[model samples]
Target: MSTRPHLLYLAWGFPPAAKSCVYRKLATANSFARAGWDVTVVTLTEDAWIREQGVDRSLLALVDPRIRVVRLPLSREDIETDIRRFSEDRALRPRTWLKRHYQQNVSHFPEATFGGWRDELVASVRRVYDERPADLLLTSGVPYTFFAPALDLFERNGLPYVLDYRDAWAIDILRDRPAFRPDSPAGLYEARLISHATEAWFVNGAIRDAYADIYPDRAQDFHVVRNGSDVAIGTDKIPMRQPGPDEPLTFGYLGTVSFSAGLTRAVCEGWRIAREANDVLRRSRLEFRGHMGVGANRGASAQAVAIAEYAKHGVSYGGPVAKADTAAVYEAWDALLLILPGGRYVTSGKVYDYVSTGLPIMSVHEWDHAAAEILSDYPLWVRNDGVEAEDVAEAFLQATKVVQGATVEDRLTARRHAEQYERYAQLRPAVERLTTRFAPGLDHVEPVGDRAPKTGEDVHRETSVPGPHAKGERVVLALTSPPSEAVRRSVALLRESGAHVELIGPDSVLEELRGLADEVITLQRATAPVKVSPSTSVTRFTPRWASVVARNLGRRHIIGPYVRVVGRSAGWWLSARRSPPAMQALKDATVLASLDDSATYLIWNASRLNTRAPARAGIGATLEELGLTRI
Candidate 1:
């Protein structure tokens, strides 16, 4: 065996996946390689990402050549766009097929989409271990399923492992509540992984505290490892130049456009208001450059459509920039638009990148957000009280002023403030701590079968943040419309009263409801069924003549679109009946309600099926039934 200690890293979204998480994952693996560990990365194949966000081949150039990467052939089926790849059932009843797929997946492991990869992950780890035992293991998540194999390895071979939650799993960080009950499958799995983990790392202090509150017993092991600016983008990119007098400013936002359409409208409305009042903004054009969405939804999301509608307001949507080209994108802008979703638990990865440019940043999220905390000390941040159009308008006005007046020294001060958040700087403490604990020649070192290193010094921990109190109740509310002020108020009251709120709605509004509800379930609507292509394996199940006929029909312009429209209409009608998960949630609900008239049918059926839980229409009536409010 080689003298160097071997490190095994399990990251599903590793490069060239084109995910924001790639920056952190790449930096981490490189950090270990630079520190003299023999690094091995196991991740999903390029095809997997191709079916999802698509790949950024440019990112692969940044990987250390010495690091060995094992790409597993794992892809998410639901995201696959090729009509030929679909099975008959997947093509015809997409929603029902997806529900069944998820049911089978979560049965094997609690995480829905990635849970089925558990066995393959275990086998991959075993193969790597058999070749040369790893001295340490690190698993990053979105697919928290990777933790399953990490824990399995630790149990079998006494391998010490780290859990890097770029975002918390058990806790819905965006909603600021437990994602699932402690007794639930996902919760139990998360708890088991944490208990056995040598270290648990979160992107920010708020997220760390959220997990710490849930697993207080393992509080000592949790650490805060913030996602900092990628060196490629921060140091390599030229700083934005201050425009001369009367120059038109370019306000830029570069990140995943994951915020809701409502948020987009609020921003555009704010931009319009600002443009009407301020000359600088009137001349300034706002450009949002990023992946608007992933998979089949890319470039066609509701947010994208909303942004397009605001083209008259000096706002435009440019497509995603390459990871290597982030600095170029930064250099083009005079000020940064830091638009993000979620409140206290979300400190977006893009915030560090924005601050690195030393450009004036306009905050378009909640005042209490974690990102706001990072920008608190920033010299040129234009603050907003909330996402309201009036607040956003004021922020735009302030940002225009900042852009017009910011001097070279002012920009330098902002950049200096962001220096502490450099990628390696944030990761150094965790890397160094692990290196010391797993140092090869230490007297504490023992045989692979018996190794259980003493708990290392607590690297970092924050005071536990108070979590939602338990009201010993669960409310499952079905919504047909995007949340209004009343719906928000009702959910807030439910959350404050310690009830777990699960909002079931169409995919279009799920993003809007995510922040208000503890759990948001998308009520699947079937789209046009994919026709089997004769060239693909799915064609094997159908007769050759049938495949040819279907292929021809799919090619006919009129037939294809008409079939799709019919499929969608049928899907919408069958949606309520086919929602097995939502139905089960309703059955288990302590109370049931509908937020709008369109949702009454689901609530009514749920009431009949779940006779014990009080079912009501409208938020006011539901609150009255729950005795939370009197009307």
Candidate 2:
């Protein structure tokens, strides 16, 4: 048997998979291997991801040759495109089959999709352990079911494991709230896993802090291991181009095009507005290079459609960029458009690479985003105040100015700013901490199981541990807009606090909020359609329309801008007026909260109409009003 201290790393999406998480996964495994630990990585077969997100062969070259990769036979059945592979049940009742499939998986373990893989994962770990006797276990999540195997190993053989949450589990990063009630099955599983783990790792501080609050006693073990750039991967050929004054600039966005269609439309609209106002921008090019969507929707997603619509205005959506070609892609661009979704919880791995490029970078996300936190000190960044078209247009103008004025010194300074976030630098401290604490042949080191498992219930029962919420409280949450991470976090806290919550939002989100809310009042979209001129009319000319348009072209153009502005405001007013349940809930609510600006006007109208309840603009304000802090 090998005498080296063995680390069995359970990563579901390790490289050759081409997912965003692969960068961190590669760096982490390599870090451990280089630290003198014999690293054995367990992951799904590359064909699994090939069937889903597709794979990049270039990433496989980056993997450390010393690290032993054990590919699992498992694949996501949902993303399978082969009709021949479909069973009779799946083919006949696909929706019902999917629901039942998820139910079966979650029944085995708390995770929905990968829970059924628990047995296979545990068997794999046991085999690895029997062969090499792993001293430590490191598991990255989503196939959080890997935690099941980790828990099994810890319970059965007194193994210590670190839980690396590339994304949060119990805390939903997208909704910015608890994913499920702490008492729920999934939450309980997370609690159990955390209590037994050697340490818990998060990609950013916000997520780490959120989890720390949930399990205060374990706060010391929670660490932030940010996903930093490899620095060397894409900088091999940083070929900087210096275009003459008359040359049109090339602005590029490189990443998975996964944001909402609304955001894409705003970007295109912003590009159009910028071109109309600026002579240089009119002739400039915006290239988006990344996977648009996976499976059947590849290149046909709503965001892809929006980008295609602006093809006449110099916006083009190229396909995915190979890992090796990343530097070359950046070489062609004068500036980078950093477009990411999610709030403070999400620090996309792309941001590090973008900043390292030393190009003029423009932020196409929220001001308070986690990526912004990293780019705060980056000198050549153009910040966006909001996701609105006007905000994006302003950012574009500012970015253009920055690009025009940028010099070699400025680029060098920007590149230097990113040195601190280089992959090994961010990861080294965490690795060293683990190395020292779990030094080889340190017989005094305590087994994780020696400490009793502390479940959420056990913590709740402790008098020293304060409860999440007060009793006999009814909070009406007006998430009239699409639910966001920030709002979702608040909702999770409210539910956990034992508050009776009445949730009012669009009908589409009812399924998502089904179990979380006490009363879900869904406001269906208005059925009445407004007659508007077809966009196709600009292409196909009709004789009667042509004469009418020619007669009042100047007058219509003058008034059309004003008309559209009024219509948008009017649309919001109309949506607010339709919800009586929302109004009544606000009146009876102990605390009324609006999650986003979409419902800010509704809350304002409600406050004036019935001033019984204290109205707050956001989840943070509501939490403060109720004197409830994360415990």
Q: Which candidate number has the best TM-score?
A: 1
Where's the lowest-lDDT run of ten residues in candidate 1?
Answer: 450-459
> What clash pairs does model 1 have?
none
Q: Output the lDDT of residue 258, model 2.
A: 78
Query: Which stretch of 10 consecutive residues in model 2 shows the poorest summed lDDT?
Result: 454-463
Per-prediction TM-score to the true structure, in the order listed: 0.71, 0.70
- Per-candidate local distance difference test: 0.76, 0.75
The clash numbers for all candidates, in the given order, read 0, 5
**Candidate 2, residues 35-116: lDDT per residue as tens digits?**
7777899988988876666677777877878899999888877655443355545533445667999999888888887888
Determine the backbone clash count of candidate 1: 0
List per-candidate RMSD values in Å.
18.7, 21.6
Those runs of model 1 whose alpha carbons end farther than 4 Å from true positions after fitting are 234-240, 440-631
